[model samples]
Target: MADLSTDIALDDERIVRALEEDIIFGRLAPGARLTEDSLLSRFPVTRHFVRQALVQLEQMGIVVRERNKGATVRSLDPEEVQQIYAVRELVQRQAALLIPLPAPQALVDQLLAIHKEHGEHIESGYLRGVHETNDRFHLTLFGACGNKYLVQTIELYMRYSLPVRANSMADRAALDISHSQHRLMIEMLQGRDNWVLAQLCVDHLQPSKRRYIDLVGH
Candidate 1:
């Protein structure tokens, strides 16, 4: 597996994004070694590209590398996961409240579409798809909050969250329940009740915190 080509050029940013998406989707497991040989074998990229990608993830606390240990996915205990989720809720909730709602309500409609798709994916028992779609739905909403600072902050937490979300998606019940929350959040957003929406966002986040602790507590 070490003879792969590096014909396709991948810049540092694209390389990082590719790895992040793959890792978040569990295509790369925690503690899985990301060797130069393995990456070369899998994709047509240079060591420079691969290192740049991994270095970005390391900075984000998503991956860690060592001389002897190589590069392995970063593992977070439950407390860390809880802290990440708490930050996500705080930043995103405030973002939703602070950002102006743009005209046409297109974003709200899009969120509904995502919820519908997630429900269908769950009903079909495509749990992985459900989690992915749900994540996109929430992130899109959070980004639309129109505050660059909040979006940037919450995105940092999501860097940690993506992997945990994927792991949690393994449980079909949990995936479905998580999808169910999307509607309530959208409803709150639609009502323009920033205050109530803030509280609801916190409430929704607590279950994730508790569940993560229960499943993989520190």
Candidate 2:
């Protein structure tokens, strides 16, 4: 497991992102405690920055802070998982419908580039890289919907889903399934099949949702 000592001289955003990466990559397991003293020691930052980072992480649904406990990586129960994925499915379906098909050559090229990088990361077994690149691919694709609020909501929901994804992110089979869907999404965009693309978008969210719920006894 990678430790804080390795993260030297990082700013607040970097700290938050690094912590989030650790959680998603399983370096910081769900329910892992996050203390100000521990975080301050890891990065050259003040308590304010550490607190701010924790607060941001909480808002992102990656961490939970209690009255007695400072902060811990967040975990979702079966019901919460189902509710979130249901909303995600709806938002993603709408986003897919909004994407203009044949998907502007520029958008297609951009998605292709992201997809290629995602594949490379998966091939190298770089879990953090895979997570990051996969996020980029989806953000870029969803952003094409041209609805700022809609895109923002989707991004928020995605963050909320990250911990759930962590339950299966390490599995090679899961990664393959995810990347395959990504490729199909790109192909659907190219073909201008909005309904199929929308259905694929909804279906794509199922595996992770099911995997997480199964782990928690859904």
Candidate 3:
């Protein structure tokens, strides 16, 4: 029974991740209804699993559930986008600033490897791969801050702004810019200028924030 329960839990998690990617990649547009019937037809899971997945998404800030409305992809207004991005910028910059100058060779090598995978995904036009690796690269970079709480805050804001950030994932030019920026970040890590690295981290977040605000109109 324990093995069976574990398998069910893993299956539920898989559903949650797939739905998350759908929302993040714009396949599931903001405000689209996530009906249980629809989800059941899509995944070979029970209604209970669908409900659990939706609850997890809600906790992640990727979905909103209302009494009569069921679940919908969470949409942020311009003001909300601005606020979330502001926090994200602050936390991410602070995390970068905390990293030891001339980052350890191990850290540099790790980031390089992730960056390489990110570039390959972009070249192959694999949107899922690109999104996953891009996230992995950023999280790994920020994790070096050596402050778990700060890194957790940075990650939280990243989750909150997913709808706003999704636009960039589908834009070719934006992806290229991100790819270049990741390479620059890796190079910056090998240097001793913490301020420059910190500023770069803040600057890296602007395009998506600006683009989202413009699209939604303040």
Candidate with best lDDT: 3
Sorting all predicted structures by TM-score, with the top scorer first, yields: 3, 2, 1
Residue 172 displacement in candidate 2 (angstroms): 1.3
Per-residue C-alpha lDDT of model 3 across residues 19-106, encoded as one tens digit per residue:
9889988999988999999999999988999998899999999999999889999998988988898898889988999999899999
What is candidate 2's TM-score against the reference?
0.90
What lDDT score goes with residue 97 in model 3? 90
Q: Which ten residues in a row have the lowest lDDT in candidate 1?
A: 1-10
**Candidate 3: which stretches are off by over 4 Å?**
none
Q: Compute the lDDT of residue 161 as modeled in candidate 3.
A: 88
Looking at model 3, the pairs that clash are: none
Highest-TM-score candidate: 3
What's the number of clashes in each of the models?
Answer: 0, 0, 0
Off by over 4 Å in 1: 1-22, 25-27, 99-104, 124-132
lDDT for residue 103 in candidate 3, whole number 0-100: 92
Q: Rank the candidates by lDDT, best first.
A: 3, 2, 1
RMSD of 3: 1.4
